[model samples]
Target chain A: MSETTEDIMSATYRALCAHGFADLTMQRIADETDRSKASLHYHYDTKEELLRAFLDYLLDDFESRLACEAADPDERLDTFVEAVFGPAEADDDGDFAVALLEIKARAPFSEPFRDRLVALDARMRETVAAAVRDGIEAGRYAEVDPDDVARFVVTAINGSHVREVALDESPAEARRLVEAYLDRTLDRRSEPEVPV
Target chain B: MSETTEDIMSATYRALCAHGFADLTMQRIADETDRSKASLHYHYDTKEELLRAFLDYLLDDFESRLACEAADPDERLDTFVEAVFGPAEADDDGDFAVALLEIKARAPFSEPFRDRLVALDARMRETVAAAVRDGIEAGRYAEVDPDDVARFVVTAINGSHVREVALDESPAEARRLVEAYLDRTLDRRSEPEVPV
Candidate 1:
């Protein structure tokens, strides 16, 4: 990104963090960047256009950081969980989660926002599903539908983030809970031992 | 509730469905109600105060509808699932899910909103936990931590709602996956037979 685009992106992030997606405006971003409104208009003609770019920036960064490749499928799954549930792992994500959620709330209304978020979700699901498929092939996990497993994992993780941001519950507890459940559900043994 | 409060709440719902939480204004609600803005102001001095009442109204209705008394724990669990996962069971919730999510997105920034949502979560956890405890006592479910089970269920359900609204995925699918997991994990039998 050019310095100007970089400055605007940072400014947008700050503005989002400060005022939230609902109250954000080009003027607010410009104020944060210490630049003229004309500077904002010079690059992006509208707030929606600018925010679309902002969402792309955040999602690209997230895809790279949270969904990296691993040698083993189990390792890939662990990496995804650790990256998501581990606090402060995503470059001050705690502060940005609310803002990100606010943008998602608008997804129902804005096709551009909706499409971007859908791509993000699809990418994350594919990442997790690929891990599950690899795990199955490697005999690390039992033979379960990879897409089903991935969808469940992604859905639960998505819910965990919302709970974390809205209800102040940690994804770590969710991680522990899901891990326990997955341990039993994904068992390759013919019989799952019931706890006495 | 008084007829006036009912009018305001219905107005709030329509306005939310039409404009969503971010753009909601008392004036817009008044327009929806076909009532004067003065009437809205007479009841709610500020939009924040009105929205607090709105959240209370929504949570109350949801509590009564989604979390209800059941004779059996399994039935209770099923009931909760049906209420949340079953489409259109929560009275046009399909229209309101996105709007409700928008309210929750603001919970991080608003104490009143956060408090109400937190209460909602606690109440749900208790309901599910109570059912699990009952199931254990009745020899219907295996010996397991009820709260742990309940927390997992609730977390997954919360996550499911976010996924449904943001990603257009169905909570019904999440329900199926969670049910399969719970069926194994909550087994009372000595062994859980594996399909493969």
Candidate 2:
């Protein structure tokens, strides 16, 4: 992202965190950055436009963030999964998840938002599938269909996160189950030392 | 549900499927039933109120439908899972799922919606847990934490459904993965000969 875009997105993130999705206004978003409302509007005309830009920024940021340097396929997959399930990246207060879910709920009605979300999920699914493919190629894991495994992993995490946001269900249990499933099915080549 | 309530719910279902959630109106709902808009208003003062009632009906309907006559634990568990994953109950075309997602997305902002969604999930979890418990009791499956398994199953289904609604992802793959996990972990005694 350009430096200016990054600055605006960071501010947008803070604004979203503070106001929640339902109450977010472009004015509030502009207030988080050095940009005046006029300047913000100059860059992105409408709140929907700004949000679509934010989603693009999010996709880019996620791709960059998932560039894990783990040594093995299993570990790489674990790291990828941990990026969401782990504390460092989880939307702790659920404000962010709620915000995303709200957007997701409306995606059916908005083509641009729908496209970005689809792209984002595609990235996640492909990244996972790549990791599984590597494991199979290296003979470090079972020869199960990589795409299928990736879909299952992604689906489980998606469900867990949604449940956590919607029902206040503990995501810790999901992490445990997912980890166990991976270890059992993949035959862990690198035992994760991450404490439960 | 009473005859009157069932009539209303069926109408509500048709309206939701036709209009989707965002455009749903009491008038549209009334158009689906014999009841006049005034009569509908007498029953539910607001669209939100009517939706809440519909959710309650859904819960009761779900509970009754899950009284699966499948003889064994594994078959019974499959039956319950099939309620969502199977063709018979799967929300084909996803209009209903999209509507629900819209409601679920706003659940955090509304207590009544949140409570009903939580209750619905709880019922799904407990039903799966009970099936697993029965399986263990009969020594037809390897012992595992029934609640844990139940949560995992529910989470995967939720994720798959959400993905299906939001990303137009296929849910058939999710069912395949979930079934494999259950058969492998639970040691299925009743071999489901259902064609995949």
Candidate 3:
């Protein structure tokens, strides 16, 4: 993993998150990572390259955690949602949530990053849809469009994190909201008497 | 309202959303508005103050549109949800949605803006809870915790916008998701069907 390169990339990602893409600079990242400017330049030729590395790192991490593992799909979906969107990790990371918020905002500006994100989202949806399809076949879930349900479920989970990060909501409140979302999402065995 | 101040603030807000808070400068804002930096500063002393003013402007606009005119609390709740979290404005003017997302990442550094957002959210929740309470009294909604339902509704609506903005989802999709959320929140009110 080239520890030095990884360190420099992580620092650059932090600077991009904390300050923003417009304020990012080699000097600032070097200062943050305690790496000399020449050393950083020797490792990464351009800021765009560094940015690409950052996205690749994140996508790799997410895929390794969510998609590349063997486990029950239902439990995997739960784990995936909790790992991606839960505020439980905020205790250890100073502002990872804020960084994610900034990254999502910057997504529209970079075609490569935007395409990667869309592809990743589609992969996650497919995984969840397959799980829901199995659940329906096994009579674990009632008849429903797996694609639509998967979209809503994933959106709700991801959306909760965005809300918490954007609103600076308390972790306790975030957990409560996530629980509420899960209850509704899992209670899909049959439709309520009312129409949505 | 001071037209000159409004113009500068509006342009500054737009630049912040288009660029970011860390990248915003009085000069760039003035350039966008076709005003001199001195003229812009004459209206706003510092960038921080200008940022505060822009935030206040959004709060004021939201309050005016959703908070002031509705005689019925339920109508107010519906209007607030529709206006704040509904489709991107028919016009190109980026409203509170973009500004809030852009500025929110900086909240950890600014107590005033963070506090204002929290208070604004609380006010909105109270309005929605009141509406839910009235609905319950009128038998339009089932017995449920109004506060919880209000919080869920607000978070879901705010969260949906992030996906909507990224996916360019249609207004119909937003309506469908919101309706599903509301249906689940009101599920307790539906009459249970008897087995044939």
Candidate 4:
């Protein structure tokens, strides 16, 4: 994408999130991006199409991060979890969680948005489930229903984002809280006594 | 409340929720309630005033329902959780949570609304903390940081509503998932005995 295209998309994303879908307009997006109406219209014919593209970008971004590179399943899951609970970007202190939530809230009104969100959630749950199943096979995790446990873990992860935003806790503190919940619920320490 | 006033107010609440705060208007609320703008202003002076009253009304309604008559702290906590996660009233489904989230999203632009939301969250945390402390004293709960645990639990409860609404499962199935999570995290099961 061209730099200007990136700017236009980012500005549009923020407008939709801040003003919501009902309030978002091409004129508003143009103003937010400091681009002319012609430019905006040339790039995005309609607000709905623009929003559809934004949803695709978001889902792609999420999957790229969550698809961990670790060969070891334990390390892979932990890496994915840390990426989620940890800071989004080193330079930007503000997390994108709030923006993500704003998008979620808009889902009820948009079928495309709801489909993308649910699909992303399902993908995340499967990622966690695969890791848990791997751990069980390796005797690193107790024998439990991987699918059920994945649902709980994914719920906790998303719940942690809400908690962090609501509580205004630091990213480090939020990660610790989420890790604690995982440790307790998954019985991470119960695996055969091993030195740290 | 007069039947007419109650109907109008309820409609306003639902409108504020379905439509984002920026999109909310006196005319829309009046239309929803089958009332005229003149009648809406007859009861509420201004949009700002109406919004303030709406928040207050919601807080009052939530508190009334959340208040526990049980004398036992654990029972009281359980009752409060049940009240929050339980079924909505016949006419009020999915409005409260949406309204809260909309208010939260707009909070950065409105200091007063942000303060009210923060206050409400604090009061909710205090109630949960008091109950958890009592559980610890009675040996029903493990020794833990009551405040932190309360924050965790409250966020979990609120986020549960989102998951419940987003999932395809029936209410019964949703409740089962939430119940399982609570049992695991709260350690609700009786203590296990060591093999002799």
Relative to the unseen true structure, what is the Cα RMSD of model 2?
3.9
TM-score, one value per model:
0.86, 0.90, 0.79, 0.81
**Candidate achieving the largest lDDT:** 2
What pairs collide in candidate 3?
none
lDDT of 4 at A105: 62
Point out where model 4 deviates above 4 Å: A1-40, A89-96, A163-173, A190-196, B1-8, B14-23, B31-36, B164-174, B190-196
Indicate the TM-score of model 1.
0.86
User: Where does the lowest 10-residue lDDT sum fall in candidate 2 chain B?
Assistant: B84-93
Which residue window of length 10 is worst by lDDT in model 1 chain A?
A184-193
Error of 4 at B105 (Å): 2.2
Residue-level lDDT tens digits of model 4 in B48-81: 7788777677677778887887767657776766
Ranking by TM-score: 2, 1, 4, 3
lDDT of all predictions, in order shown? Answer: 0.80, 0.82, 0.66, 0.69
- Residue range A2-65, candidate 4, lDDT tens digits: 7887788778766655565546788888887778988888888887788787777777867888
- Would you list the clashing residue pairs of candidate 1? A159-B159
Candidate 1 lDDT over B6-122, as tens digits, reads 889988988887777777888899998868999899988999999999989877876777765568777787777776676653456566788889888888879999999999899
Candidate 2: stretches off by over 4 Å: A88-92, A189-196, B87-92, B189-196
iRMS of candidate 1, Å: 1.1
Assess candidate 4 and give its TM-score to the true structure. 0.81
What is the CAPRI rating of model 2's predicted complex?
medium
Q: Each prediction's DockQ?
A: 0.71, 0.71, 0.39, 0.35
